[model samples]
Target: MMYKADHKDSFPEKPGLAGLKVLADQNYLSDPAVFRNPADAKTTLAGELKALAPNNVSYVYFGALPDVPVAPAKMPLAFERPDLRLNGNLCVLFGDGHVESLTVPVEVDDCEELVSYLHTQKKYSEKELKALSERAHLLDGELGL
Candidate 1:
């Protein structure tokens, strides 16, 4: 789903990308430009490009659990709220680089199970990983990097 500052006041009229084919076509998914480390760039080109085509950009933030193999007896609350239920380990990032947090839900005994479940997820699958690597390679080729 695409989120914009101007549209923050209202929810999207549609859920997900349905009738936005033309817009999607013009914008590249998994574009290396989106992944280029903003810190490494000496100039403001990255910011300029992001400003020019904000929809085509995405910044991923992978949150890591402190003790991977061992899940705590009581999971940390996302905030001060005690009634809210937090879910399992997630790799979520916002379109903007504003927020990043890890929320894992599972007992110490279930850590292996959670890991296994994550391994089966399509995003971490070998095929998808290879495709992403190839896409990055292709982008580098285009840039003559």
Candidate 2:
């Protein structure tokens, strides 16, 4: 709202996780706790959004989802805990305001598999990959992926 008002009714051009801070930076959003990943009992909001959680955050913006040709409902706006976190269940929010928790198909279940899958689409920093790897666990248990 406030952000779009000032920026030609638009959010950041390529809003990533840190882009959420763009709102905070403008005082549009003040609490970084809203962005904290519940799965990660470690880092704080400052370390997560401000420092750009190389490890993992609660939600990630799919800023690159095609806009012109694709419909809003088809576009992925953001997702929660896709990095083998939260029991492989991802809460995806589409551009049309629909939210769904999708489980990663059994085939791609571990950090290595998810990392490889991401490799096909985008490049993640080695630090980020290592972080995901360190938390990799396929079972449904506490802090177990």
Candidate 3:
């Protein structure tokens, strides 16, 4: 609301999860409570909030634009409830402000593809991506990707 009111009904400049903390610090949001996911009991924003650490944030932003001009139905704004095995689900927030929960099959190929995409986008360094891929299987239950 604060962002849209100031930016002519536009969203924030970046669509990353970290941006939420930025907004909170800037007073656009009352606090970082909005960043907390219900399923993640371990995460909190009471103390100093750091986007890089993310502590317990369950959702991942999909590189949304500042103005958010993409098609509402197709664009995935964020997702959560990630698991690698045993009925893990992906909850997606569409561009239209609608939430949908879908079962996304987590396979080795899918994980590899996502790692490649993240590397191409420079979300992490080559070394980090390599390490993530190597430990992807071990992190199945704990990984948020």
Candidate 4:
């Protein structure tokens, strides 16, 4: 919210993980540890964020927010992918700053199922593909999934 107030009531141009970097740089979200959701013990941000883990924070961020004002419930800023996080529901952060847990159908606890799901996405962007690929490889080598 403070970021919006300073940036003409708009969000960072970059979407997803990169966009979160902006907030971190601006001190809006200072603690890098907070980026890693507690449920996601297997994944962690690389480089400066290294914390006895590999990769980046977990969550599918929707950074390209709509310009026109709309109901907060309709604007989902970020959501947790419970597949590898070992959670049965998705923890979503809405535009209104409210978090909701939505039940999903994925086999949350099984790392093998999570890897399979990442590989079978119908239409994933290059970023998604890279993330999914890295995560899959990590699971294969580390977790023996």
Candidate 5:
């Protein structure tokens, strides 16, 4: 939030999760350990504290976040990458600054889960919805759903 406050409510825009470097580069966060999940042993602590590599990071930064969204609580910011998720659940960081564990469900779930939940439950504007879907597709592919 501090970074957003300073940077006109925009996040570090980069491909996939690499944008997280903005946090360290901009000094919002200095430690790479902060990005890792303690439960994930596969991901090692970065030697140089950079999110540039997927193996060293635990989460995927969804790129479709709006500036000062009206329903921040309903938006998905970032989530634990599929391999990092335990027991078929991923921890999601919402726009409201809350974290939740989401059950893994493929489109076969009828609801198609994940992105479907965002579209139906959140009701973001057309532009925001398009952005969210684009980013969510990348994440869904990683999750294999």
Candidate 6:
């Protein structure tokens, strides 16, 4: 969904996806349909959290449900329907105990890309590299990426 600032007065708290096993219990993990859309695609919040167990990584998600379908092809022909509503946040816990919130959609992609790129970073910590690989595997499981 397109990002919009609803409560501009408060800086949204950044939380990491790591260590958030509760998501599996939230309707998100149980509802098979949630991940069916391409635009709805994402690495399981649990998986991302698990991968960051050894590093300083955090994430948060906030907003209404994304209006974009997982795949554009799945969008309806009707062009004037009201958008769906989705609201939530994700938090990540890094090895350093630092937490951050992922407030934007593209931020998620950038985070994943950073994790993937970590594999090639010179002198990157072995712990961080392993976490990134694990996170990549988790994404593959959830998004088939």
- Best candidate (score: TM-score): 5
Badly placed stretches (over 4 Å) of model 5 are: 64-70, 106-113, 120-128, 138-145
Candidate order (TM-score):
5, 4, 2, 3, 6, 1
Model 4 agreement with the true structure over 1-145: per-residue lDDT tens digits: 7887899777675555566777777887776676777767767645453232325566545564343333454454665644454446666675677886755455544333443443353344455445444543444453333
* Better structure of 3 and 6 per lDDT: 3
Using lDDT as the measure, the top candidate is 5
CA deviation > 4 Å runs, candidate 3: 41-46, 50-52, 66-69, 81-86, 108-145
lDDT of 1 by residue, 1-145 (tens): 2433344522222211221222233453334354333432322223433242213222211211232211221111111111111343233322232233445444411222223333343234455334333433432332232
**Order of all candidates by lDDT, from best down to worst?**
5, 4, 2, 3, 6, 1
Q: How does candidate 4 score on lDDT? A: 0.55
TM-score list, all predictions: 0.25, 0.57, 0.55, 0.60, 0.73, 0.26
Candidate 4: residue 37 lDDT (0-100): 73
lDDT of each: 0.28, 0.51, 0.49, 0.55, 0.65, 0.29
How well does candidate 2 match the true structure in TM-score terms? 0.57
Task: Locate the minimum summed-lDDT window of 10 residues in model 2.
Answer: 134-143
Ten-residue region with minimum lDDT total, candidate 4:
110-119
The regions of model 2 sitting more than 4 angstroms off are 1-9, 47-49, 64-67, 106-145
Count of clashes, each model: 1, 0, 0, 1, 1, 29
For residue 89, model 4's alpha carbon misses the true position, in angstroms, by 1.1
TM-score of 6: 0.26
Error of 2 at 52 (Å): 3.5
User: Better model by lDDT, 2 or 3?
Assistant: 2
- 1 versus 4: better lDDT goes to: 4
User: Which residue pairs collide in model 4, if any?
Assistant: 44-55
Model 6 CA lDDT for position 119: 35
The residue pairs found clashing in candidate 3 are none
Worst 10 residues of 5 by lDDT: 105-114
Better of 1 and 2 by TM-score: 2
